[model samples]
Target: MRSSNLLKRAHSHNKQTLSSLLHSRGTSPHPQPDTISGHKLIEEETNPNYKPEHWYPARIGEVLNHRYELLVKLGYGMTATVWLAKNIHADGQSGNRKYVTIKINVNTLGEDFQKGRRAIAEKLFSANPQHPGYAHVRFMLDTFRATTKYGDHLCIVYDVLREPIDLCMKKFPGSRFSCGKLRVLLPALLKGLDYMHSECHVVHTDLKPDNIMMGLGDPNLLDHFVQHEHDHPSPRKAPDSHGRIIYTSCSDFGESPTEAVIASAKITDIGLAAWGDEKNTKPIQSNVFMAPEVILQAGWSYPADIWNLGVMLWDLVENIGLFDSISTEPDHYRPEQHLGLMIALLGPPPKEFLARCAKAKWYFDADGQFKYPKYVAEDCKFEHSIHRMNAEEKDLFIDMAKKMLTWVPEERWTAKQLLEHPFLTKERECYWDTPSLSRASTASVGSLIPSRQGTPGLGPTSVPNGSIHHSSLPVRLLELVPSLASSDATEPRLQRQSTNGSLKASENDEKSTSSSTLPLKPKMETLAESKGESNDETLHKKRSVSVNKSNESSQAMIDAILNRGKNHAPKAPAK
Candidate 1:
């Protein structure tokens, strides 16, 4: 007992010492006034490595231009660390203090590549000012370059998002998305893709569940939190190197903080986005999600993205990959197996598709039969495949998938064309017919919300007041093939020129690749948590932690989040 008490006292003393060191660095726990504008003070000049700092502007507690304060690390990937930051310019606008996602580009691209990235990203932004406001696309608010010790860092600011679609699937009772929710989400994805392809002239080569994000938090409260920042003045807080909090944003909500809702879905991570006209020589897209023509070294374009979206849709609703993503034989190439699975499920490719494929001989004979016919029929089918959806729904889904997954790239429907397909538009009014449907769907998952404890053990449930029937999520091909699941699926897309620099591989064939790899579930943090209110170990260790500080609205948000999960729980599998 005496030793335990001594240990507690020692921990307390050490924490206090750390606090004192932090306080000594500034007058108040907040950022020093001069640095608030994101400017380097004269004292910083004494550090001979000031220029080097510019190479890496993403340090914890680092203030930029004295305006944006890096608070919590929302996430990090190969090339960037996404920080949740507060704009501290004291612009006297309430919105200045609201949360923003700042993506700081690592010095991973060569000078030429970096220039190309910057130009393309800017073109995308300038092409359509209203594109960010689209329901499906992640909105970019600002962009700038900062010099650091490592090199010049390219930074882009965007609105904060909740979690990706994969988590939404896992959070549900049986790890599946409800049909109605899928109905709402898939179309939103199509609309965003259409807008990007037609309007922005961009092709998001990497389209997968990891890239689709669901919005959380009350839009009204978040809006109010930012818009009224001058009036409310959220106290500023910063986390230490160990992710310990030394300050806090003192923003206050009167009595009722509005509850958070699942907003409309959006497409994110346009890092590998290329213009439709540009013919990229390098191989692109993740392997499992790659289009057939891409593997054959045949030219690819927008239709490839459509194929990716179709596969992504299957993964989203069914909780399983449409393709095997694994190899069956040592000598037989994996891409051939990928095509074989397609044939086993959708039938043989057309002569036109076979003609276009330069390497068709590798997988198919002159007569269009798979070189190894047995691999096609027997190996692809799994025990937990999608066998439960009613015949009508299954037919509709297959119809759409077949249309998009055409062997001939040109035969696939354009984004705009897919939007018009009966599958996407039949059940509900189209995005063009009723603009308000987009807004309505954001807050529409009311009764469908689940409790906070965890997903319910119950089986499939209806999508609250909707016609579509939810089903038990099928196990993915990768899950069935343990070896394939463990393989680095995205690596082939890029041939690492240097461990630090980014390079696209012409030979590797992942359908989508990015500078960053996503976590199974992204950690969602609130404004309070961002301000160093919690410690690092606690935040990182907890898979899903809600903001539990004495804020009722935060508590309400947690309840709603959990409740949302319970509402989507699936039924038990049949005997």
Candidate 2:
């Protein structure tokens, strides 16, 4: 009878509207003894690390703090168990009651450690709400202590979110995100980083796929999950010798609508984050994604996060780690082996860079050469590793990665500068038609003069002019004139000449390309005429050329723009 009733409930659940499913006004049904079974195995129960004394035995329908009622276990990690819970005390219609995620940490962590972690999150998330990147970071809503027979557990509350990015990647073929998906996800993540670094002054030392989470793109996912769980209670194991029952976690949120796309992402887990002013020698970041400075104990800061993100991004796109040589064995990772892999891909670290590193002597000799030269894999080059991209796309992606993966911390591009990278902004250029360009030229030219103040997190506002940086203008100009790009088809697209060097665009052969002799007026008139612009509008638009430069002159300007970074390369800061 119970089995038949559960089947009927599930069938009825499938036909209910999302609103009716989630906002149903009634007390949730209690888990019945007939529904509990000891046959199904729970993964956490089988783990050797499972300790009954350390974990809080939270049961379904149990209310914590007299407010939140536990609905179902979402996941469990080494240190915590997460659950979906309802705010019974929230003032709303029964069907419209608020729901939240409760992360209950292991009692072994102690109250102080959990409180400290909560403090850091509260300080950073509330630092600057007006910043654009604020929305991309997961904010902590509340925290409290729950006392039980086992020990005191610290419970942290947050708004409900979808699963982590690592799990999301498994849904895609080859376990990789397409460049199109990256275009959407990466910017959202970068915005979060910009907020953490620029506005909050917090550095997220750990930034692997697990730390980044996908947002709830579909509103019905949570509703469906709740209804499904209510209909069919999760199977549970019988009591152990210590009388602890382990329940199977229900993590599936159901298949998304075919048209739904993951349009938002948020950076979570700031427990490892450090303030910019608190630069220390303590090691940070995951093993494979560790920045050179961090591995060497060379006093890292914001740039470490950039390097971390760059490697993680590569892992997302290529479905493998860039530094794959690092051992995964617990407590057996060798820094020298990781450094060798870095050398194989990024060439040798600059002697000046190695000089400041406290641990560099262990890896490099007095001459600044790798002590274990044979460990360097000669075949592991950056360009050869990238697959499935055309020459232009590959070049742009490499350019963006190189800016972040530099050995010198000062050389790495800041989060704001990377936002304007050609790889990221390529889609925006498609909207620039003839009339759009004619109107936007003045404003775009004005953007060339980097703003020193006004908006935050837009560009370099504090750095001096001679600092090592990539200019977005040259790429913007090339994007504006597609004819000029086509005119010099033979010219090499933007490519990295060396691992340690600045990126350079091609200087077309002087005599062969029409760009050398092309006049601005004829091109503008042709563009206007092609767009069916009246002669009078074309004349009026011609006067809008704020900078009195011909196409030939603009070509010269682009060359200057490409070479400017080399001339302004910044010196390493004093240790």
Candidate 3:
């Protein structure tokens, strides 16, 4: 798959280069696609095939509302384009100019625009200033209609913000933020989520990386984002034709002055957020961040936000997507595969939760295996447990992931509940010492070590003999020493020899196992040899006893261990 993608990209690159050369010499390589004429509605914005008219020919120094001047385009989304503009009336204060972000809705009469306007207006009018999340939420300053050459575009003004958290992730790559930084950012996000759910009675249906923007305090990073007037389909310069900048009215497309601001983290873009009581069967959330309840058409509320938050945190920390929805096959079913991934990483959904799901049969059977195996082929390659952290930290995070991503929406932890979890609270770092019975009765997260046992198992949830099992080795050690159990069927058997000097493998199997066993290397023997100084006598006796035991089978592993004795200087045979 990777090679195929590289080949295709190489072909495209060569083709583009050839085309560029031809175009430079007054020859047409390929005809351009036709552009469509329209009022630039939602269909135009969404359809890749359509080329809608620009809502704003936003140029430098364009003044709006007799005060705000459009300086640069910060970003754009489905229904709106946000621009960084300066306040002409406000004087500079605190070493920063009073800059604002104006979000102009593409079509004022569009349904999305009206709905968003109503939602924001309602929240602002009734919003509690004392709410804890208020500081984290983007502050909406004003709203008005900007009459352009095309039509009146609805515009909402806000204090200028830095880049979104996604940009921050891209900037820092692996370390999205240090643990110290996370301690600050995550708590603020949780506080915001708690306040929105409990006090504002709102559900932020779309809370992906793009929605969570940075606060203004960081370096100015908007120059590259701004679209120059020459780059626009039509530059609304004065009729002088020399293209000198000019401002006609509060309605005209003209240049705006600029200002600088720094960045931090804040929750923005509440266009899709809904009242808590609103009921609908429509889909919400970015595909990769979609909760199981949203996919199953089961009802959802605050907990759904918690699920998104958890996944986002994973992406921020790990620098990789926790749940990838990209389909390998063109015909692959997404929901089935997404659910399969959830099950593979966590565990099976509760039967009662499955009973409530309308499409449960399509995804899971009575025994919890995926019904459509082909659709979820991607999940087949995933390990049952997260293989990234130490046993303790791995246990801690998986427990948190499980709590946020439960099959039952009701069973998932709320933002407030999660904020109190030991993973988030510094004071409760040692809380794992107290065995809190897991929400899932089957097993606690610490027990589920990723193992070679064909099926990854919760390691000795209960020891029958009250003695430690071989599997009880620290997960770190298990990682270093590959488990024999997960190897090919014909591989040599590996079992602990009895302390009474009996060999673990039977004699009949000895011949068949030798060729299958890995070759012994000097470096591999160092681990076994480090335990004792009188190593030669101990090694010689073990080899002799293993060969003498009729019950013993393949001595490949024992031979590998004993071979280390040969690598040592023929130390004077102990008298």
1-575 per-residue lDDT for model 1 (tens digits): 00000001111111222213334444443434212212322211222333322335355457876668775444444455566677766454554236677877655557776666566666656656564235678757787877744557778888776556664565555677655456556656776876676566577888887777766545444454333432322222243233322222221222211111223677888777776655543466777777877776566766678889877766766655777455423344467667777777657877655776778888878988788676586545322345646443444455556557766664454554444343443332211222222222221221111111111111111111121111211223212211112124344322322111223232222322111111111232443266655644334333222111112232343344344445555878999
Q: Give all candidates' CA lDDT scores.
A: 0.49, 0.62, 0.48
Candidate 2 vs candidate 3, TM-score winner: 2
Candidate 1 has its poorest 10 consecutive residues by lDDT at 1-10
Q: Point out where model 2 deviates above 4 Å.
A: 1-49, 91-97, 256-261, 428-575
- Tell me, by lDDT, which candidate is best: 2
- Per residue, candidate 2 scores C-alpha lDDT tens digits across 1-575 of 00000001111112232334334334447644223445543544444466877778788898998989998777766667788898988754444237788888778885566666766798776888987779888888888888878789888888887667766676676777766677667767888887887787677888877777766656556666776677656655677656666765655454431213354688887767786645467877767878998888788777788898988877888855788667855477888888988899888998977988999999999999899988799998777778856554565567678766878765565676566565665543342333322222221221222211211222221222211112333555554433223233345444422211324343332221110010112335566779899855764443332211222233343454445444455888999
User: At residue 567, what lDDT does model 3 achieve?
Assistant: 47
Across 496-575, the per-residue lDDT of candidate 3 in tens digits comes to 23222233331112111110001111122354567653545443333332121111221332233234334443778788
CA lDDT of 168 in candidate 2?
Answer: 69
Clash pairs (backbone) in predicted model 2? 23-95
Off by over 4 Å in 1: 1-57, 90-97, 128-135, 220-263, 324-333, 379-384, 428-575
